[model samples]
Structures are given as C-alpha cells and as structure tokens.
Target: MGDVRAPVAGLPPVAALVLAAGGGRRLGGRPKALLAYRGRPLLEHAVAVVRGGGCAPVHVVLGAERERVAATAELAGCAVVANPDWASGLGSSLRAGLASLPPGCSAALVALVDTPGVTPAAVARLLAAHRAGAALAAACYGGGRGHPVLIGARYFGEAAAGARGDTGARALLAARAGELVLVECGDVAAPDDVDTPQDWARWSGQPGQPGWPGSLGQSG
Candidate 1:
C-alpha cells in the first residue's frame, strides 16, 4: 500500500499484482510462494514473469511464510502486501493486492505464484488485450480460461468485491463473460497448477535436473 515506483511516461502503465498468499493446504501445508523452482522461490519466478511481460511496479500479495519469503526472496523493486487473512483463500489475496496498488496505474495484470507453467507470452497477450481497451480479460488455455486476469482501473472495485474464497475472480469473470476478452494462450503456455505433490514433482524438476533447490533450508 506504500508509494509505488513511478511508472515510465507515454506507454500505458500496468501494475502487476501477484497472488502468492495461498497456504498450499493441498500441497502438504507448504506455502506455494516459497516452493522452490529453478533455484529460486516460486513467488520470485512469478514476479519475474510479470516484469518480463512489461508490467510496471509489481505488487505481490504474501500470506504463508510472509516473513520467511521476505527474508529469502530477492523482491528488490516489488511492493509486498501481506494478507493476515490469507487462510480465507484467493479472494482475500486478490482484494488485498488490488487495494495495495498506488494511484496513477492504468490497469492490473493479476498473476498467481503456483502457476509456473504460465509463460510471459501469456501475460503479454493479456496486456495486448488491455491495450485494445478490454475492460476485463483472462488467459484461456485450450477450451478453458486460466490465470493472470486483467482488471482495468474502471472495474477494480467491483472485481475486488466479487472475488470470494477460493473462487478468486471467477464469479466476476462469469458475470462479465459478455465483455471479457479471452486471449488463447494454450499454444504458448500450459496452465498446470502446482497444487499437489505430483504437480510439484513434475514442475520442480527431477532428481539431478536443474529445478528446485536441493535443500529447502536455504528458504530462510
């Protein structure tokens, strides 16, 4: 909620809001944000993706291991918003993230930490859609929709109010289906979630493969 990094001029400035607060109950109580990926925390990777995709002054919503993540991850330029009620679900994180954005932002490109498979290209697609003037938009994988939904400044309040529990922004997206822009990202990305042990095993690298850190102790 503090002052955000001043955005560059001319180009439309979009703030990247990363929802990394989930407790990862299904993943054996591990904070999904702290989960290791390619020698860094999953939360860090999510932040990088958003930045690479052209979002300015990224904001990350942290819940589980809020302190540990701060001590460990390299969040130099990001604004970290800790949600004490993170146990409530993605809804709380979503609301907290939206509220934390500073004034003068043009839009919010919401991303999730658990989604490593979501590429920067997918995020760029959402940014493109937003530039085209879509009030609401989301990345669509194959026949279904997925993460990193774009909420323009006009609908920030309504979207935050409607995001409830584990549903996140699903309810809002459904209600605005007629106006929502679905950018197909299946060809360039996979919307697989690291919500289970098996899911982690696949994305976190195999034994000896360059993936998650060998020891979790380095996390803080």
Candidate 2:
C-alpha cells in the first residue's frame, strides 16, 4: 500500500471524532480497535482514512484499552481524549470526542474505530455533501448506512448534548430526517465493521473490496 499521506487538496479544518472506547466483548476481550487485519490495527487504518479524506485535528476517544488507543493516536499524530464514561456506551464517547474539538470547527466527521473499512473517498464525499449544505450526510453502501457520518455545525450542539447513555446521534438524525442526505457509494467497505472474529475473517479475504485497507496483508 502507498504511504498514508494527507490528501493533496488538504482536508478542511473540520475536527474528526474517532470512537475507540468499546470493549471488544465479542472478540474475547480483545480491543476491537486494536485488532489487526492486513497487518495494521483497525484504529490506525481508520485514522488514515480520515486524514486522507482531508479532515484535520482528529481526536480519538479512548476507554477500554486506553493505553493502546492512546499509543496508536500518538503514532498517528492525532489527539487522544479519554472517555471515562465509556462503560455507559457509544454516546458518551461521542460526547467526549465532540467536546474535545478545537474551537472554530464548522463540522465534524465521526467514525468508529472498529470500522476500518470506511474509505477516505466516502468520507470526502460526506464532507462535500456537508459543505454543500446538508445538515447531516452519511455514507451508504448496498442500501445500508455506515460510518464516518458528517454532521454540520448546525447540529453539533444537539448531537453533543442530546446524546445519552448508549443512544447516539441516531435520535437526532431521526428527528431531522428532512435534512439528512445519504450519499450512495458502490463500495461495500463503508458498511463493513469488524465486530467479531468472523467479520474480520470475511473482510480479510476481500482485501480488494472498496473502503478496506489497500494493503490487506502487509505490515504497517
């Protein structure tokens, strides 16, 4: 695979909130974000996609494997924020990452650490739609919505404040359905997340699949 370089267009100054606080119970206590596929931690691949998509000031929320997560973030050259309330669920981590965003960010690109397949192109597409005035834009594949959803500044407060327990921005998106824009992507990678060992195995076999790491079996 090519070097994980920033995009030539240079990502906008939007902040990215990478949710990496989940305890990988399904994977036998293995931190899902730290799981390797194609020779790189899932979190590292996820961060590379965000960086390649032209988003800046990326912040990763660490919880279950805080040290490992923080180390990955440091290696990626992105900021790391601890989500002490991670046991409460994804919403809390989302809130923590959002709160850590630097001042003046007009929008945020949110991605899950376990979702390493979400592509930089899909993320850039979401950013384009958001910049084009969509209140919320998500990447869709095979008729299924997926990660790296872009939320404009208009709903930042609502997303950050309305989230509770494990209830995330889904509620906000449902409440503002009329303002949502779904961008169709031919790549199934956007919708594929490594939740179990089975998922990792299946995705590993499909390295050519869109949204997945280009170097499926290469060590980073």
Candidate 3:
C-alpha cells in the first residue's frame, strides 16, 4: 500500500518467480491465488511480499485460471508468463518462471501463491545470504525450512536443466548443501500456506478463532 523499493544493500538485481499455476483441486477447482483473504486476493498478498523484498522484474506463472490471474497480476504491476504444462505439476510452472527471468538477473527469489504469509524480511534475509555467496538460501522457522527460497545465478543452469517434473530445488540444494545458508525466522506465519477451506478459515481467523501469529499485524 506504500511506495515499494528494492533494498539498498545486500540485495542484487534479483527477479522474483512467483508460482501460481496450480489447479487448486483442494480448493474445489477454484484458483487459490484468486481467493480473497482479509479484503485482498491471496496472490496479491504474495506479490506485495515479493515486491517488498526488493526483487525486481517479478514474473508470475499462470495456468489454471490464466485470464483471471493474468488480469490480477497486471493490475498489481507484475508480468505474467503462461505455463501450458501446469497439469504436469509445480515443476512445470517453476521451469517456465525460471526461463522467463531477465537476462542479467543475479539471483531469483521464488514464492508460492498459496504461501501468502511469507514476509519481506524473510525474503530479504534469503537475498542477504545469497549475496554473501551461498549457492542456495531458504527461510527456516523453528528448524523447518519454508517458502520464498533463493537460488543464485550459479545454479541457474542447473535449475533450468532439470526435468519439468521437479517441484522444488531440493536436489540442486542438497548437492550444494555446503554452500547453502539458512535464515532463522521466528514467525510461524512465514510457512503458513492455504490448501483447504479449513486452512483459509484458520488463517483468516474467522470470528471466534485465533490464527498463526496470534494477530495479523505488519510482518515486515
């Protein structure tokens, strides 16, 4: 809601690859990214977080609800890239996003549409780790690794070289664990992702409920 700018230091010309190509079967075939939460679409929150993280040239991969998602993304000032192989799974979307990154991107910050609670600080920490020469960086909360992962250009070819079935960068990161950095984030909301109506209800804190983070305040 305010003027968003890239972080001044410890952040390179990073591109954000937001994966929103899922079919959302658990959401009754509805596009999860378009689902409303706290007066805004879930995808919009994800985009805001990425932009707040100081990533430039954000590319959103759309498939299940292409037209609707693209229009929403365009309104949010994000570029949309179609993922025809979305039926194949997340790997296809990831590959498409990677291929769409700008030519001079020094690194990429990847986020999932369903994981709307990831914070800008968490993303910034990942970028800081990557800029410090880590091949791979991820946000970790209470020892569990979470979303909005960062991958350096050093592994760009390796990530893009994989088959379209790969859903995550696990293999690539595992092979280079010695160079991986983990930023410990105490916020549980950073890993919260919506999959079912129950999940949404819980996150939104319907009337008598208490949600993760106890209360939703500014997460930056």
Best by lDDT: 1
lDDT of 1 by residue, 1-220 (tens): 1112233469668999999887777676778887778877888888888887778989989998799888877899999998999998889999999999999788999998888888788887888788788869899888698887998888888889898888888888888889988999998778988767667777765443333332344332
| Count: clashes, candidate 2 | 2
- Model 3 residue 184 CA deviation in Å: 0.9
lDDT by residue (tens digit), candidate 3, 62-86: 9996987666533356788899889
lDDT of candidates 1 onward, in order: 0.81, 0.73, 0.73
Error of 3 at 116 (Å): 1.8
Best of the candidates, TM-score:
1
Give the true-structure RMSD of model 1.
5.1
Q: After aligning candidate 1 to the native by TM-score, how far in Å is the CA of 83 from where it should be?
A: 0.3
TM-scores, all models, native as reference = 0.89, 0.84, 0.85
Per-residue lDDT for 137 in model 3?
85
Selected candidate, larger TM-score, 2 vs 3 = 3
Model 1, position 145, has a per-residue lDDT of 85
lDDT of residue 101 for candidate 1: 91
What's the best-to-worst order under lDDT?
1, 3, 2
